[model samples]
Target: MAKKESYESRVEAFLLPLMEENHFELVDVEYVKEAGTWYLRAYIDKEGGIAVDDCEVISRQLGDWLDKEDFISESYILEVSSPGLGRPLKKEKDYVRSMGREVEVRLYKAIDRQKEFTGILSAYDDKTVTLTMGDGSAQTFEKAGIALIRLAFDF
Candidate 1:
């Protein structure tokens, strides 16, 4: 596995039990490098919402755990926070829960000259997602070609 994936998987494994114990959902974990520093970020949520205190609690525990383990070779900033409203759907559970909900989809390549679409999520499986567009057209998107799929929200 790539180093980033390896780090993220290890972090996910460690967080699984903590997540269950705390009644929190693990949205996503990422190990990424910015300008010069590496960052280990955990996105979490709950039925109601995540508060600052929740993030602080998780961050403290996770930081301590990472320190004790010391598996990662690089120094990184550890962050635990809520996946905001616009967070992309990156897992099966996310797709399942989003059924029948309106979603904004972004594709790696444009289809019909458009790379973005907004529609009701009608169906999804391991490889594809079907959306019912505003004009009642059903658009099937290959999951591999999708850059992002997230619940649609208006400000």
Candidate 2:
């Protein structure tokens, strides 16, 4: 577990400067094994949205750097892409960006007999989030109580 985290930290350190130079926001990085294959994925974004060309450029540059560094012992596939519309709010910046947006919140335990809440993200602080529900009432939840919180897509 520590080794995986160390690898992720190393990758983040390597990618941050590259991302900033290219005017991209480094959203998240994950090094995971799936289907017997190791994959390193970098999620990035910008003011509008990321293009395929952006991913291609970052991929080429980062791939070259990774090759030069030779940090990972195992073979891995590298992917650079945008975080989708429903991306989870994993950091303070994410929450700040998501203010006033509709969000779906799942809790570790039920609140008012409900485990999930869908509402406009009215406000958030370091310790709590306030959602304005459909009935015009506001619901406040502790940050620690939330299991997951992401942008909600209405379809």
Candidate 3:
């Protein structure tokens, strides 16, 4: 696998169980270098929301576990935080639950000459998502066509 994919897989293996044990969902993770420091940032969240205290607790616990494993050789900063508004839709379950919410989606190829769409997520079914466009027109997109999907925080 590619370096980034390998890193993500390793980190996911190490952290997923920890997040599940704490009743939190693992939103996403990034291993990147910024200003000469490698950062391992884990975005976590729950049903309602997440708070600083939750981040602190999970960060401390996960930090202890990471230190013991020593999976990362370079000096890296670890961060655990909420996904916040406009959170990514990482899982199929997330897409299902986000029905009726606004979403922004990018497709691998243009469907009807457009590769991107932003609208209300009217429904999500077995293999497609129905979107209500700004003009009140509804369209269905196959899951395989989606390249990126995220909640649209119009607030």
The best candidate by lDDT is 1
Which parts of model 3 are misplaced by more than 4 Å? Answer: 34-36, 106-116, 122-130, 139-148
Tens digit of lDDT per residue, candidate 1, span 39-80?
999999999999999999899999999999999999888989
Q: How do the predictions measure up, each by TM-score?
A: 0.96, 0.85, 0.74
lDDT of 2 by residue, 14-115 (tens): 889988898999999999999999999999999889999999999998899899999899999999999988789988999888899999999999987999
Question: Which scores greater on lDDT, model 1 or model 3?
Answer: 1
Prediction 3 TM-score vs. true? 0.74
1 or 3, greater by TM-score:
1
Worst 10 residues of 2 by lDDT: 1-10
State the C-alpha lDDT per candidate: 0.95, 0.92, 0.85
**Per-residue C-alpha lDDT of model 3 across residues 121-141, encoded as one tens digit per residue:** 998867888899999999888
Clashing pairs in 2: none
lDDT of 3 at 84: 82
Cα RMSD (angstroms) for every candidate in the order listed: 0.9, 2.1, 3.3
Displacement of the residue 88 alpha carbon in candidate 1, Å: 0.6
Candidate 1 lDDT (Cα, whole model)? Answer: 0.95
Worst 10 residues of 3 by lDDT: 2-11
Q: Please list the residue runs of candidate 2 whose C-alpha ends up more than 4 Å from where it truly belongs after superposition.
A: none
